[model samples]
Target: MSSNRLKILHWSDYACPFCVIGDKRLNEVLEECNIKDRVDFEMKAYQLDKDAPKKPHLKMEEVFAKKFGISIEGARDRVDRIAGIGRNEGLDIKFATVQFTNTFDAHRLTKYIASQGKDVEKFIDLTFKAYFSDNLNIADRNLLIDIAEKAGIDKKDASKILKGKEFSDEVRKDEEEASDKGIRSIPHYIVNGKYVISSSEKSEMKFVLEQVLKDEAEGKLNINE
Candidate 1:
């Protein structure tokens, strides 16, 4: 059966804790509205730290401190605050253990997984867990393959993609599109290609979706005007 549904495009990065929370909150709203299948959701790649080293250049706490010009103890407190927020969302984030590295490969892997028609949302969720909870290095090809396999992607195909440049263009395309959209931060969401929500607030996400869904049903939503 053919139907009209709101299409939601999401841009996020694996290293972004806020993106994780934002995605989770969006899912919560979708479930609450009983519209999970009514919304066409696509996850796009966004690298929070494109210039980050392939290996951990410094501890995540130290990186935070240096970037924000704060003390190491202050960085730890900031991380703990985010982790506490994640815990409220049922995610246990081990920010202290996270190996801060470039997430380009991780984004490429997600593109490849989507190409295979697998559960990209599940794959993305697992990728966030792999980094924030398990503290796995998302830049590692072997780790990506293992994570993909766990997400039900074929091991052989995952291995091939990880070993080569497959889906690299798709990753770049997502990043370029994000740039064009003026997305300066992670967890940016565009609903029905019109409505833009740039926060991780569950209530705000719920309100946006509810309004969009109503407007969509009434034939009143138009983005091309």
Candidate 2:
């Protein structure tokens, strides 16, 4: 944060619907403010349910109802509400048929892509679509390899990474750091390593990021990341 640009650390899960909404809104603000080049993004991985199975065995509503002790109707309402938000953002989020599965491999693959200085955002966006829109199983190695290749990653390299334990530590480190900070939410964004911003408040998010830019230009004291 004691640097010339604004730093954005976003902690989110690929399988989270709220993350889809938040990410879309945040990117909109960045583009609208015309501050894309003045900000740096570090997309950290955080799984809501780390123990989720590699393949979903139930409908999205059924799983939510069982997990939260709610009626199937109530669970459907919950998912539908989030889907409504995604619709407002012009996204296709079919949580009703979501393939809710373990995201460890997807997160690990993202870490590997970022480490290789590849198009991390493209890969992340593509993976998000695969889960929320296509209702595809992100934990599937073949699906991951396909998504990675479409994101401009080498198909062979992605296959090798998925076949082995590569970049797992990076994903774990992100999770551990979020835990130490007592962060228990997805689509959480930290600015300057201090101020927390959420896309849930669009005006506030725009204001906060713009303020960081102004403070940086003025040489104000910044909280270092």
Candidate 3:
């Protein structure tokens, strides 16, 4: 088998619960196989509820109910289900405390973090936990800088990037690219530049990765998405 790694471009939004769940599942599979070195994962940006109002720091349940026209109880149930999935993957998802905020700046910061070749996975996990579990407003620059520093980013540089809208264009480009590819949902995984798995269906994700590795082993350069 060739030692080539498969590249997976994952488009997701930190504000979305399902995207976080999908990310956890993908990470689990990669870790279980000891294939961290064999997989190149890039996280793109996608907004789930782009039109949500930015004020009063609505809870996840409130946001869900308002956006989907469902009752608060129904939204809570949905959050519970998603939270259950997250808990299984070692995430402490606090549905009630989740504050849905504009993630544009957060996405920009992520792009900047990737540019630094830092541990983006840890950065992303911390950002999700901060916003969804710790009730931190991700759109706030100070909060973003703190999270970035926690992810090993330089405090001064993180503050500069967050304060000045650095990497915002790159983030917008990523969103445009996702739209160009007809991606309308979060947790979209584009594997090997061909096989596109929408949402993190764990079994499907594993199968796709396995196939990519198999093809690489056979000296075949097939793009699946």
Candidate 4:
């Protein structure tokens, strides 16, 4: 007699707009499945630009153009395409105003909040909203504390966690584990420790979750579908 719960591991970066869209779509799949209590969800750390400066000195447009060798207008058009997709999912991605900074500290704070048995998704949502929608700096300590408080995390506890390296190791561990799995992209989802899905399309994610549940209920032990 064993418990039949789906364990989902998601690796993402805060600076990646695609990860933001993917998170929202994944949530929709979970909600529609009506198995909130039957699933175990975990967000892991994977920095898209681990070497990024703590405080970025360039605008997002310039950063994009320089990184991809495109004109500023071309960068805007490219990001606008992703922003259009986000709008379809009821998200506001203000790419022009977003401050792209290192997300290592943010990941550490999220790890600490999740360890307290709190709803880590709430904090993750706040992080995305603060960065993508409000264009707030996610690396700011004060801002992180405020977001934590809004997510039901104690302000004092959050402040303390930010002041020290309490969850730094946990964040690093997640990155290392993901690297061991040969994961090279963000928003990667692993279901039941076997099935792997890379796309963030809402319909695809919903179909996979439903399929996993159906397979488990049918006593299928080797779930590769």
Expressed as tens digits, the lDDT of each residue in 65-116 for candidate 1 is: 9899999999989988988999898888888779999998888888887877
Candidate 1 colliding pairs? none
TM-scores for all candidates: the values are 0.92, 0.92, 0.89, 0.89
Ten-residue stretch with the least lDDT total in model 1: 1-10
lDDT of 2 by residue, 1-225 (tens): 332576789999988888878877888898887766767888998999999999788888988899899999999999899888889889999989888899999999999999889998899999999999889999999999999998889999999999999898889999999999888777789987877885456777788877876776787737466
The TM-score measured for candidate 4 stands at 0.89
Alpha-carbon local distance difference test for all models: 0.85, 0.86, 0.80, 0.85
Candidate 3 stretches greater than 4 Å from native: 32-34, 53-56, 222-225
Over 53-118, each residue of candidate 4 has an lDDT whose tens digit, in order, gives 777677788888988999999998887888888898888998877888889889999998888888
Worst 10 residues of 3 by lDDT: 48-57
TM-score of 3: 0.89
Please tell me which predicted candidate would have the highest TM-score against the true structure. 2
lDDT of 4 at 52: 77
Clashes of each: 0, 0, 5, 0
